[model samples]
Target: MLLAGEQWAARFEEFQREAWRLETLPQYLMPQESEELQEFRDGTRIDPATVHNEYTDRLRRQATQGRLQGRVHIVTRPLAEYLRFEFAWYYAPHSLAGERIRILDVTDRPNPLDGVQDFWMFDHSEVVLMNYEPDGRQINREVFEGDPAKFIEYQRIAISESVSFEEYVTGFDL
Candidate 1:
């Protein structure tokens, strides 16, 4: 089944224990972010420390509730512009709000999870596969009914191979 709107949003809120994501793309073309992306390109940027949004607000709440949220983005160095924007504007603030962001830099090594699709696994049992177009436009989110053991393994591999977002950004020039 495909999830959208409130259904998709509910997955985040309703997860009982933990919510995790595996991000495989370098650029996600969100139409809602078009204006902000243009602003970034135009040399206007917000201080990540001051960023406040619905997502970040949710992250703060989840942290206070003792629920966990995290993601590991697979990337290569000399990052894409969208990635730079994401790191500066989204990941930085989200991490500070208690989301555990990690980076798996495969710049000099073979991708360990090469064929794995992007997905969100809630409570390590429910999996929602994120389908996207080649240019990074979201297609739809599909509910994966299969056993989540594979996804759990993917998460393990991702965490084992990646560094914390703080570690990735420290002294690292964007």
Candidate 2:
């Protein structure tokens, strides 16, 4: 079924062992981040030391507790402005906060998981499909409980083919 608002928020708190996300978009339109995004577009940069949210706090807690929380974002060269902001402001802090971030730069190589959309695989048991529009507006999350084997495999493939956030960023200009 479709999950949005509180339902989407609940998944993070509910997942026991791991909350793995496969991010296929270069940017995301987050309502709560409208102002920040706009400022980013206007040329203000986010200080990693000051960038934070409840979500990153949760990531810290999970990491301290020996739980896994991470994601793989597929990106191309000449990064999107939002992505520049996200990596500089959002992803950097999240990584420092103990969330594992990987990048799949498919600017040259063929995407191994071309057809896969964004998704969250919880504890390798359930999956939540993250639906988004062309401009990166989130439509809603869809929960899939039947069998998550495919998603689990996708995670494996992503991790194997991707590089750590630090390595990836250092190789780029952002």
In terms of lDDT, which candidate is strongest?
A: 1
The residue-by-residue lDDT of candidate 1 on 64-173, one tens digit each, is 99999999999998899999988887888899889999999999999999999999999998999999998999999999989999999999999999999999999965
Per-prediction TM-score, please? 0.97, 0.93
| Per-residue lDDT of 20 in model 1 | 98
Backbone clashes for every candidate come to 0, 0
For candidate 2, lDDT tens digit of each residue in 1-174?
Answer: 998778778888888889999999888988988898888778886667775688778888889888889999999987888788889878899998988999999999999999999999889998999889978998888898688988989999999999999998895555
What local distance difference test score does each model get? Answer: 0.94, 0.88
- lDDT score, candidate 2, position 158: 96
Cα lDDT for residue 63, candidate 2: 90
Clashes of 1: 0
